[model samples]
Target: MWRAIFRKKLFIAIMTAQFMIFAFDTTTRADDVSIGFLYTIPTLMGFLIIERGLQITIVVLSITLILTGCFFPVPIETDLLVFFANRVLSIITVLITGIMVNYRVRMEQTLGDALAKERKASAMQRAFVSMVSHEFRTPLTIIDGEAYRMGKVKQAVSPEDLQTRVKSIRQAVSRMIVLIERILYTSRAFDNKISMHLERVNLWTLLKSIGRQHSEVALSHQIKVNVHDLPVSIRADRNLVTYILDNLIGNAIKYSPEGSVVEVTGQTNGTMAVIAVRDQGIGIPEADLPNLFEPYYRGGNVAGISGSGVGLYLVETFVRMHGGRILVESVEGQGSVFTVQMPVAGAEPAPAVSTGESSFPDKQ
Candidate 1:
């Protein structure tokens, strides 16, 4: 044990200095160099205890200090108070530094946790989109094959029967393709995966079809869908615009209770397309409106509602990408309204419309 202490740098220096201290007038404890010899070994011991460098270090230092400093006396003044004071100071320093280091380590761990969550969310989005590709590719391949086979059969089959079967097959395949694309787009948008590609599209024609498609739903709901402008085209991605409309119109239908009003109105005011989807259903609470676009965030009245909470988020992202904005208005039990403003190609807010809205559709 004594040998191990002698081998340590602190202990060796202590021994060397002890020899030097005695070489001079050995009675002075306050001589800085002498006090250094007086203080060194105990400080090392304090560090050992606090750093858990003991059981290993103290076993040796314990025996050595007792022997050299107390057991075998050097005919000099050894003040007990000074020795203890130095040890206490060293221990305090070790404890405080240790605590701070631990705190920093904990903070780093927390940061890592947040980063991990974000990464997991991103991976889930990618996986969801990837599945869309795989699933759609298979159905699309079958559709292509069926269409090709039926085309060949056209040469042999009667034309009347052929037309009906072909039309059904084509329509069904088209719907599937559109659904798949919507899923991909919507997922990416909600996942915060945004990089838009902007292009020019006739605003009037786009809203006209969107209005016409939902015409039956509007009539049933007793809602009127109006296209404010007839032939004005806007600079934006047509696919993304379609997705935004789908969510709005679809949501209107979902919550409309079979005979409510839904209005689809649009206009190119100055340099943007102003589109609004208004419906009469169970209105959203004023408090819940803030989090409407948050993923999985549903309102109080929507407790049993069949929605994934990705709609408004996708809408917001798409609108922003087009360097545009969205606004909502609602009163409890009256209904809700959502308006989207998208920038023109060369107008203010040069941002483009990011595609991939069909990312998270109503999961069936």
Candidate 2:
């Protein structure tokens, strides 16, 4: 704010200096057309700093007319038409300068806004890299340790035990793959390369597949799915839908304690499909809920949790791409429910870009 005020004051000072120069020359050298042109300096400067550029131009034009008339009076013996024509030419020049000044100012503003967005995107990219490194390390370490154990205990370990170890390693790899795919998809989305190819998807089968995929993680917890009554099929982008479910369920498992229930439910309401992932986990803080979907934003309760804070952000993005909305309802200790509402096939038109805030239930 202070910087804006300083710029305004500086602009006024520059304009004042230019007007003084014009006034001095008018008295000493009134016949000089260039002396009258000095007023354009202040008029253009006003457009650069002030939003009221048009008003400033009019003020400068009026002042110049008055000062010029005082000094360059039309002699009663001189031809009146010649004097009027000269004055009219000077006024036209001032008007053209004002228009050009305003145009330049608008162009500068457009460039400034684009530069700001570029900077923000750069920051997000840096955060994503750091997060990927941190998240990948844990899974890679688990896989490496298991491989080392298998190498050392070869033949000595029973076939059953060997199978279990291999399975564990595979599960770790699976987790890593999910994370990597999300990163790739998100990158594509950023590049505007993500496209929705809607096809008929069986919700029941999809839910069961997601459950089975995470069976390793579910060994210590329960993923209760209740989608039997849901529409047998819905038109949606299968890959994007999978991404959304993966994040939601994966998060529910990650944040919840061992043996906690992570419930998945689906239903149909009119032309919309409703799906929710409710978890008995460490619930989001009411204060932090509003920024939950913001890129790289983690809640206060997520300390020590292994998360990049990008999962929910990607979930929101994919949901919006389907012309749907995601809503969050949480309590500090009672857990949170993420409810998604998307239109059924051909129910609503999806746009290339969407604008809206994700819904957050009021804190109770």
Candidate 3:
């Protein structure tokens, strides 16, 4: 803030000095003595103004002042030719100075932008490392705890208790597998190496399958699917579509309170297929809506939740890859509805690139 105030003051001072120079050249100078070149001082100072429009205005103003100064009185013995040449040279000097200043400003802006991106990438890398460490540790700790408990039991454990312990361990392992796959998919998406195997897929069947998978794991949350108006089939990459829905449904379950209903609805809008996942979760904050899909950006409200923050990023990326768009609506405490719309006939096939990974994993 202080820097901005100083810059504004400096700009005003420069403009004041510029006008004083023009006054001196037009009113106080003898005709033969050409000090029109002094206008270049203000033109050089224009580097302080980052706006291109303002820079161009300053250049034009300097040239105008130089030309106007030419009309003032001169000494009776002055050589008209020399005076005319001097004025032209002064104009050229100001123009060149303005050009150089503008070029320098542009270079500085570009360099600044590049540096900012590098800083943001570095910050995100640190966040990714921290998030992965925490996410992995939770499940590992759970698995270890279960094992330790079973081993310490002195009496014969009941079959039901043994089965329950095994289920807990398997769930922990499954959570780890999902985390690893999400990271892999995020990397592949960033590299633009995900290849689409486009085929005709039944929308209703796909939603039902994904709903079932999430339902089994998130037994506390009820999953509902309504697809009566949805297009029967869409030509798309089945696996990518599955990932998109899976992430959306999974997130809805993860963020919402226990026993909340997560409704998956679909409809047809002209040639586009529209699907929406509505969750009675802690809705996102208004400030986070715009950047919700940025990689590794979690909502400020989800402090204790276990998430790598790449789910929505990948969802949006995959949706766009299939030439679809996603939209979201939410209130702070009510809920969020994520809507996705895509052409029934999928996008043109992307150029095949080897991602060096197998197809999306099957549910365990």
Candidate 3 scores a C-alpha RMSD against the true structure in Å of 4.7
Error of 3 at 206 (Å): 0.6
The best candidate in terms of lDDT: 3
Q: Per-candidate RMSD vs. true structure?
A: 15.2, 8.6, 4.7
Ten contiguous residues minimizing lDDT sum, candidate 1: 22-31
Task: Quote each prediction's TM-score.
Answer: 0.50, 0.64, 0.81
Please, what are the lDDT tens digits per residue for candidate 1 over residues 1-364? 8776655756545544443443232223322334434444444343332333442353344334433543334434646555445434433443465455546666787899999999978876665555456556655776777678776763577777778767766765765755555566665655566555456777677666776777754567754556656237676666667778877877877776776678887766776667888888888899999988765456888765545455676777777766788898999788888888877652344333234352233322
lDDT of each residue in 1-364, candidate 3, tens digit only:
9999898768866775774575456333535344555554664665456466665665567556656666766656767766666656665665677677677878988999999999999999998899899999999998999989998999999999999999999989989998999899888877877777677889999999899888887899999998888999998878889889988998899889999999999999988999999999999999999999999999989989889899999999889988899999999788999999988998765565323443666556
lDDT of 2 by residue, 207-252 (tens): 7889777766469989888887578777777766777887798888
Q: Can you tell me which runs of candidate 3 are displaced by over 4 Å?
A: 1-78, 350-359
lDDT of 3 at 178: 89
Q: Which stretches of candidate 1 lie over 4 Å from their true place?
A: 1-109, 112-182, 190-197, 229-231, 267-270, 303-305, 346-364
Which lDDT values do the candidates have, in the order given? 0.61, 0.74, 0.82
Which is superior by lDDT, 1 or 2? Answer: 2
